[model samples]
Target: MRIAFIADPLPSFKIHKDSTYAMMVEAAKRGHDLYFML
Candidate 1:
C-alpha cells in the first residue's frame, strides 16, 4: 500500500519530531510507500 501526507507549509511539518514524520517512518517500516509535501 501507499500513503501520501500533505502538510501545511509553516506549522504542520515540524521536521524530525512531527507526527507526519512519525507516520511516514512507520509506513516505511511496514513496507509501504509514502509521499510528503510541505
Candidate 2:
C-alpha cells in the first residue's frame, strides 16, 4: 500500500515520542511506499 505523510518538515521534526513518525517508520519497514510533503 502507498502512504503519504503530509506533515511539518521532516528535518525539523522532533522524533522523540512521535507516534506519527513511529507509524510511518513501521509502515516503511513493512515495505509500503512512503511520500513526504513538507
Candidate 3:
C-alpha cells in the first residue's frame, strides 16, 4: 500500500510526541510506501 502524509518538515518532528510520525512509523512497519509533502 501507498501512504501519503502532508506534514511539516521532517526534521521538525519529535518522534515520541508527534502522532503523524508515529503513524508513519507504523505504516512503514506494515510495508507501506510513504511519501511526505509540505
Residue 6 CA error for candidate 1 (Å)? Answer: 0.3
**Judged by lDDT against the true structure, how good is candidate 3?**
0.95
Positional deviation of residue 22's Cα in model 2 after best superposition, in angstroms: 0.5
Q: Clashing residue pairs in candidate 2, if any?
A: none
Name model 1 segments beyond 4 Å from true: 8-16
Tell me the number of clashing residue pairs for each predicted model. 0, 0, 0
Point to the candidate with the largest lDDT. Answer: 3
Residue 23 lDDT, candidate 2, scale 0-100: 85
Q: Name the candidate that leads on TM-score.
A: 3
lDDT of 1 at 9: 67
For residues 1-38, write the lDDT of model 1, one tens digit per residue.
Answer: 97888887636567777887778778999999877676
**Two-way TM-score contest, 2 vs 3, winner:** 3
1 or 3: which has the higher TM-score?
3
* Candidate 2: regions farther than 4 A off: none
lDDT for each residue of candidate 3 in 9-32, tens digit (9 for 90 to 100): 999998889999999999999999
Residue-level lDDT tens digits of model 2 in 1-38: 99999888888777997777998999999999999887
Ranking by lDDT: 3, 2, 1
* Per-prediction TM-score: 0.63, 0.82, 0.91
